[model samples]
Target: MNRRHFLQLLATLGVAGCWGSYKAYATTSSAKARVLIIGGGAAGLSMAARLNSVLETPDITLIDPSNEQFYQPGFTMIAGGIYSPDEVKKPQSACIPSGVKWVKEKVVSIDPVTSKVKASDGNTYVYDFLVLTPGLQMNFDQVEGISRSTLGVGNAHCMYDYQGAQNTWKALQEFSQKGGAGVFTNTFTKLKCGGAPKKITMLTDDYCRRNKTRDKISVTYYNASKDLFDTPYYAGRLEEIFKERDLNICPQHRLTGVDTASKKV
Candidate 1:
């Protein structure tokens, strides 16, 4: 849905991100309304907490199946061995806000027309209002010849998931020891973090340099976009740095396939 429609829907229930305004009005205006939130990630919890804090008596229920909450941005750091995997993990229970009903379940499908949500438990929940923040999914299968099973094999590696990042670390250590060409590529899609590809590339480059394998290791960056960064100033500086470091950058080229058998992309 568009931003205007999304805002109008929430505004119908007098829901606003601002705690002070919501507290001043929503409690008196919409306290009795039943609110069900899908997903227990940062956005979902923050929304639930704000509602719980502001409502005189919140009727809020949050549904999420995850046993643990992850600090996703730290995946790159984990891949580089800069931070341990445990540092990014926390029990989902600990992060959930107080005064809210928590249901450890996944949503099978949502029937917006019927104001119903069907979950993994085979139950339908009806709500006066609903919020969804389940987060993003990576579609590795969309790339020709690439599958989830292909990761951490040969030169194939990614740092998007916790296990994938840890595995990438292992592959990186071995690759660095016997220096060769390493390819770092970005997909042409709305990825979780825009800076993630660049971070992974630079981190790998740093590791090679520190290990005195810079001359032996050739790092090539394949950027789907023409510019390194969307912002002009930063993009200019990044380009300069890449040139100084003698890094090869192939812009406007997206990775469409993975040839795992031949170890090519």
Candidate 2:
């Protein structure tokens, strides 16, 4: 639906508290509305909390299958050995607002026409207003010879997943000790954090440098875009730093597949 139409619908349902203006209003009354949130990630939980606080009697139902809410930004830190996996995880039940209802089920399909959603448990949910905060999903299978189950195999690791971040840490440690060509690349499709590929790349570089193995390793970063970064303010300086460090950067190179057995991408 269009933004205007959606806003009008929310007003019709008595949920006029927009996120932008929610902070300005005090909760002296309750809103008679049913808000159905379809995710339990940061966005979903945060929205649920805001609604619960602004509305005294918030009939909010959040549908998600995950048992834990993860601090996804910390995943990169975990890969760099700066944070542990447990540090970035919290129970989903604890994160949800006290009054909000939590439905621990994945959404199978959503029928906007009927204002109903079908869950994996074979139940349909009717809602007055819907908030979709479903987070990104990684498609490792799109890359040949590399699936979610085979992460860390042949030193192929991605920091996006919890276990994958830990595995990347392990691989980084091994790489630091036995220096070799370390390749880091960005995916062709949109990703959660654009700077993550650069973060892990530079982290690995610095890791080897601190370990006194900098000379033994050759690091190369492959960028799907022609520019290393899009921000004009920092791109020039970042390029200079990469050049100073003798880091090989190949632009417009999108990773299509990988050969885990041969450690090739």
Candidate 3:
């Protein structure tokens, strides 16, 4: 759905006060069903909001470590030098519903039998229902000879996070000045946003062209996917753009390792 339609749906659903009835469910002596949500990311918060709207005063608790709520899609723009760090970040308090209890802690372990979760802060919470929305973990170490520290410093970099996006912007700026070839690689992992990798690459290419250093710098895209884009229509458009710009595209090549010393990604 488009942004306007989505916002209209949210408004129609009374998202703001939808959780008032859920609070009643918590206070009612009938069952006192406790709902525990793991992870305060988009999925977790969205689930919490919807449940609150359906049930009256529902007993729900959201657990997460970070205090800031990030709009991940904006990271691509940040890497493109279109947005600042502050513009993409929001206080967690602002995104979370008012009635739900916000727990600032990390989940250490889950005892499914007892319906309890242990936190890193030496506390445990019990729940009648559990929702797991903790986002997937990125294993940069899986790449041979590449450490987590190699990103943004060495030849390797990714724009998956805010800090990483900022680092990518810096890397692009530096690369523009030095006029060297760079490789942007994307694996076939289940990433949050599939289009983000190419978006950043295209933005970097645009940046180089704008700075009149396009000839000095060559950006190659190594995507593990079978096609540049999944959808046929979008793929055709991308193919046309790539051909028009003469951007190097490598399809179906997975990233194995980064040769930092040789700068061969």
TM-score of 1: 0.88
lDDT of 1 at 13: 37
Candidate 3: C-alpha lDDT: 0.80
lDDT: worst 10-residue window of model 2: 20-29
Off by over 4 Å in 1: 1-30
State in Å the error of residue 193, model 1. 1.1
- Model 3 — TM-score against the truth? 0.84
Model 3 spans > 4 angstroms off: 1-32
- Give the candidate order by descending lDDT: 2, 1, 3
lDDT of 1 by residue, 9-112 (tens): 34543554433443443433234667899999888987787667655667889999999999989999999879999999999999888889888989999998
Q: Is candidate 2 or candidate 3 better by lDDT?
A: 2
TM-scores vs. true structure, each candidate: 0.88, 0.89, 0.84
Best by lDDT: 2
Q: After superposition, how far is residue 185 of candidate 3 from its true place, in Å?
A: 1.1
Over the stretch 1-265, how does candidate 2's per-residue lDDT look in tens digits?
Answer: 3556546534533455544443453533344677899998988887777667766567889999999888988989999999988999999888988989999999999999998999999999998779999988899999898999988888888999888899999999998888899999988797999988888988888888888999989999999998888897777788888888888999999888899999899
Residue lDDT tens for model 3, 108-177:
9999999899998989999877879999888888887676667755657788888888988888888898
RMSD of 3: 7.0
* Candidate 2 off by > 4 Å: 1-30
